[model samples]
Target: MKLARLAGPTPVRDKILAIFPGALGDFICFLPTLDKLTRDGEIDLFTRTEYGDLLPASVRMRSLECYEISRLFVSGVEEEEKLKRFFAPYSRVYSWMGSGQPDFVRNLTLLSNGKLKVFPFRPSVSRIHITDYFLSCLGAGSSDEITPHIPIRADALAWSGRLWQQSDLERKSVLVFSPGSGAREKNWPPDFYATVAEWWEKKSAGKNLAVLGPVEEERDKISGRGDRVLALRGLELGRVAAVISRCDLYLGNDSGVTHLAAAIGAKTVALFGPTDSVQWAPRGKRVTVITRNVECSPCLSPVMKSCLHHKCLTALSPDYVIGRLEELLG
Candidate 1:
């Protein structure tokens, strides 16, 4: 295919294996690229254990199991040994890595044990968009080329349907508030989130909080509402994505779940604090990034390791988010 023009002279499909050992949202973000490979090859995935279910339906059916590789993407002979074991049968392996295990993917496509190895990359290429980086690896032209998306799993749809039946919610214009992400450092104030949620609840009527990720402790602090929020901490990764897909709008910190919302086609509102909102903001999808753009803003991802006083997030008020939501919802 024209997409495989970057393959040089290698075989079309050498038992392809893709790796993306990272956060759930990050993995979900890669699903679009995975979708493009739909029915093209017998793909094996090596991602974080938690995100095993987050992959798209078409991609997931291909093959292989997702095992936890490592928390951080480290590379070396030892890591090469792991790839050596994984790709023993597969001749062509590609790890979709911008920050994940690129080395493992690179080492497998070697001729003289890394001496005659070739990769789909060149110098002066760094800090590209996440989707572009991966699609480039798989020989796709540009990430902006607008690829096809796989449908949600049938099981997930049935599960989500049952959830609606179980709840007293009217299933009206739903607004799902993902009130957690990016840790306390990059997270906008919880009260700020509460204020936005309150406004959305009033406006959207059937609006409620999804409380995505491990937000059980935080969900308890959401006073004045009993059934308005659903703690999805116990829900599996696929379940979380399905629930978010059911929403009309999603709002959250600039974190993985925010990206998941964008991936699933929800009109996402992501709050940016210490992180570089420019680079970390949700991709091509419909997303509105709310940041103050202060003098010291984007300090977390730009310059410093972490900011001491997180005024950037504090500056993001409820009124501000609600204003953005009003525009987005309209």
Candidate 2:
């Protein structure tokens, strides 16, 4: 109940609704705060349905369609009265989607009108990790030791075991590589990943590359080829997380998959480019972030609109990543 001290003036109530939409890593970053919130009472989640299995069974997960009601409220399509009535049951609604949809915060606050408390999280433009920002939104102080919370179910672990067994790769020390990200600009070139895979295959006999992500669904983009390199494209999110959980190391871009890998306790070597590594890198005990010190780097913009050449990622040579990979593996 102590962690229920959210930003609004209203008293803590029996139930709370947390509106968290897309971007898997963002949701993972908010998990620690969500875990703390659950101590107060049952928390209803509004996130992408794909992540429902990753969360604890105690919490109730809702579909993405359920969150469209807020879009209507923000767009003025739904009347303020209807919005108020729809959310009246919950004692308070805490939203972290304000950064993407500023109007959602304004409309929700207006509709609440002191009847229901509303905490629309909007952190200042500071150089802090995203997880820190998530905690700060709930009035919690930042801590270096604070890590993302991801609970791997027993079944997920079983699934991972089956994968290794099926491939006759049970004894091999696995290295998961997620070569793709939502933003193409942030990704280190696929050739860089292939170089690492090649080096890993030669250097270590009992090693495997568990290539992950939907990006591989487009086969032409990546040029990695080796019997040891297993492409695991289009697997369910939970299954992907499960497989990464068993791996000894994870090499990836600043992507959601990297966040999941780190959250589940894999040693992570994340290559960050346009996105600020200081503010967005994965947070974990064994996480190492590699980035080029380009002057115009970390544009902090969601899209690479202005810069046609992504020197930040391109400059991060494969040798540099391989060196880091060696340091972690050793």
Candidate 3:
């Protein structure tokens, strides 16, 4: 993705804090709200430190994994003075974390002098997209369409360019595949992805690259096919986005990387299985979602966990996915 140019940083006036302890996809959904809040005041985002590269330069990042922040979850007025000192700088706080915990909410509200607003991490119902649900919580109209975008840093792009050169694919059209998702049930079969890759390579004469995150690495499901595709492993989030930005098309399950691919404006085809695609599908101008309309699909997480047969995903053949990709490309 190209880096988005912004007018100089917003002037620091009132300090505003946003606490998000969600995964990458959830955080992407919250970006529009973060952008909106920045217009009101300087924003401090408390999230995983690794996501720092994805934030706008004006927004400050604090590590949510630190012990000091974890203190908020403990029940007590014991750390009152310390917590007060920490939150005193913020004029207002919007937290998607700890909404269900009365103690956390009470403490944060008391410490921030009632300036802390808490919202559920996810909507109670799946009637609306997560992005719209987040915006609605911030008093924005649900009808407003907010697409999350990540500006690629120059260094990451340069690194990706070098990778392409080294792989002897600098002039080739490339299709990137990510076959693993956070949930095992969400993933389509690895062999199915290989089949699609073969079809893509044959039809478009394109190079194939597979992004293997820690989850995929642990499972050892999609590696060992070096002859068919190049693998990207052990890269930071920023570099991963950079690699994805240069792809002609990206294919993945309902995973964070899939959301990243869409956010960075990569043409993406998302494969959905046990999840609700309407609520969780990646949002972008050039994104397509492929799913089988199994009667038992879109089941609750508990039901998905217990399901022995992932008919929802298994029923979606590689040929069907390839057909969708062809339509999307056209």
Candidate 4:
């Protein structure tokens, strides 16, 4: 019995830290990796503090200041001794602080002096879904299905319920629409969105909720004229996610909020223009990506081309979108 009791060294549970100072979409893509890591052991996330309320229950959301400190450490503005303290707490650290920052990763590894396991994450495959790429960086391997997971808090749900009640949309099949993107060209013409809103309201006999972000407020183009379509603005990301989760369907451009809608399990129709849908489209079983495939379309980058007229977007008629909407709603 004693001979059988010969023991190996006690195993240590992995304490993981992930630094991703990125936007909402980027962080959403990385969520599967975070979910996987949490199954193994404890994990902490260093992302935008503004999104702290929306992080997964499995991971601890650390302050954005931690990432800024990491940047300082990489830049050599802070000494190794101070930076070592930051690295010492975690058994492994995954830094995905934007792509093309190899030097920063190397600096972080050096500062840790081989005592900490530090890894830098970047996307290599342009064709694959970004979730797959993010998972690869964490050595989590690739998933055939790339779905985003967003957590909606109780306060947000309550807020959304209140908003719906106030707008007299509580009893209707609520359809949420977002007409904003980082770039103007990625947006389907405002008239197209308005037309879709009007048609959707008529078909589903549902109330349309137009949720616009700060970028949209300035343009002031996408709007619903009647009481049947309510225009909501200045909502927090978490609140928007909660509202989308309650909605029957989501219609939006290729934007972060579109990704958010898909993550929260809303059936989504994502309009695409010059941007690459293969790489950036919202991933979900119920998601439909509509694009007019032109020879020069899908510039594969967000940087708007000099093609003054965005035919890729403008050419997509309201009738075509309505046909897709029928399929989704049916």
Candidate 5:
């Protein structure tokens, strides 16, 4: 359905709804694109309702709810009928997944009674970062067309900064280390992280260093050295984004936090394990990945039978990563 087009930002009703499914970091990357849309129409969101309240007030201008549009089909075919009746009012329907599921997009098109128009941006890994890739879903055009912006809450930044100041860092090149990843096999040894931290200590003398993660996940990465490195556990994800944005550099395993760091414009050094660099590495000019260039690795199929060793990460010594860090910091 061609639907109606808003050619030059002409007159239209105010309310418009955007369908997005992801965390705050994912949504932050879509800010530039969303901001453009909001200039012409009021942007509502369909996401985990918790995000409705969690988003900063600056972003709160957009209404949000746990509208389970993505779950329309899986629930049952009959549920699709309800979606059609429910969404018939909106003039624009956008799927943040962008060509995610043909059926899903078709459903939105159907629900809008052929009155809603669709726009999506899909890009390859080398051509654009995931953030840009996401912006593309909003029909974003060029790199400059989608500017990088993070709506950080002042209160959250102040709270996180106070927590950061409590550390022993007397003004050092702060590095937010995340020795964690989505897959269990992707984590480098905590000892290796400590080794890199210690090595960087001499290089970044007078700089602060701390690791961010859930306390339950990585409490031991900073066990003995209370003064050198601080482990910030139990931070809200939005606050974590705030902390990462303020940091000079981010070093970590392949994880959402790595994405968060790069999205925030921090210089990042990401370590690859099972995930492919071409597909999953942070999309930034300043970002670099340190891996041993192992063979038969990056097998990211979610299931593992038995492997000889996790040499992909173990083969990369702290010295090698630190050397690259020196070059990057230079």
Candidate 6:
């Protein structure tokens, strides 16, 4: 009698490792390149563990908190053998961290046996769209479409459904707002968002939900609005994506959640003030970017911080944003 054969696990074709320390928006910009790389080989990413849910299933995520990993930044390798052993598994390693540090590049190159490639954390002087810049770093052509996609897990969707039911938003057209960004200067005023929310509810009879991260949690941007508006605070990135995915439309400043909203394919309206929307706007066919073309607009972080009067954003009245929303939804 012939014995039945058991199939073993499939071997990874080409093992690649990437060390990325970018925030959510940067990671979103890097997603297309990650997708491209996945076609060539299996990838292991060293990044914040919270981003694990956002990555493709083929990619394995490793925590960047390893003490040994931090040793790569030191000038002299005190644990050369251990570091070399750790890096021996991958055929090549790409790092978005420590590109500006000569010691890190030199040490990592030596330890990985010259298998390491380093790219800048972000574009230095170039005003190119970040997605295109990442592709160019890989010596690849521009993406025909720059839309970055994140697949919502079944569990995440279930969580969203539960949240929607709990929030009394089931079967209602919802508009989600992310009113804050990493920089206060980039924000288009909480009162401005409130004005927009009032208009959104009155015009469309839709529920407005404001998602706030650590930065905006203390500010109470969208409270005292009764049942027409709800505020979601202290949610993980995955849950935030899920909630945004269930929304009819999304509006936000240049925050990571805004990028996430676009990546999740929500119809998004991105507000731009100090930042240049041309280079950093969320990429999607359904996304609209609103900016004030003031002569002193698109200023750098230094200028933005020093600016006494933020006319660039304050000038963008609630009426203008509502008009844009009408055009977008129509």
Off by over 4 Å in 1: 1-13, 36-40, 56-86, 96-127, 143-150, 215-217, 301-306
Residues 1-330, candidate 6: write the lDDT tens digits.
999999999876888988888888998999998888888888998998999889888899889898767898888993578887888888888888998898889888887789888999888865788888888877888753867998788898999999889888887789999887888889888888888888888886889998886664324756656665788888878889999999999999998889999998988889998898878899987788999889997888899999999999999999899898888788
Best by lDDT: 3
Which candidate ranks first by TM-score, i.e. highest?
6
Find the 10 residues in a row with the least total lDDT in model 2: 113-122
- Tens-digit lDDT track for model 3 on 125-163? 776898998888889876434799999999999999999
Report the C-alpha lDDT of model 1 over 107-140, residue by residue, as the tens digit: 4435123322223422235456565655666667
True lDDT of residue 138, candidate 2: 72
**lDDT digits (tens) for residues 75-160 of candidate 5:** 23434656666676667766655355566566656666665544444344443555566656556665633444445667777876
Candidate 5 ranges with C-alpha deviation above 4 Å: 1-10, 23-36, 49-71, 74-86, 96-110, 115-147, 168-170, 206-211, 214-217, 303-307
- Candidate 4 structure quality by residue, lDDT tens digits, 1-330: 456667899777788877777677777777787787787778878778877766777678877775544574456633556666766777676676633565565666665554334444545556777888777765666655758777679999998888878878777888889888777668888888778778877876888888887775423655537565677787778888888988888989988889888888889889988888888888888889999887677784434656687888887899988988787667
lDDT of each: 0.61, 0.75, 0.86, 0.75, 0.63, 0.85
All candidates: TM-score: 0.75, 0.85, 0.93, 0.87, 0.73, 0.93
Residue 116, model 3: Cα distance from true site in angstroms:
1.1
Ranking by TM-score: 6, 3, 4, 2, 1, 5
lDDT of 6: 0.85
User: RMSD in angstroms, all models?
Assistant: 7.0, 6.1, 5.7, 3.9, 7.0, 2.9
Instruction: Say what the RMSD of model 2 is.
Output: 6.1
Superposed model 2: Cα runs more than 4 Å off: 1-13, 67-86, 98-122, 216-218, 221-226
Ordering by lDDT:
3, 6, 4, 2, 5, 1
Candidate 1: Cα lDDT at 54: 62
Instruction: Flag clash pairs in model 4.
Output: none
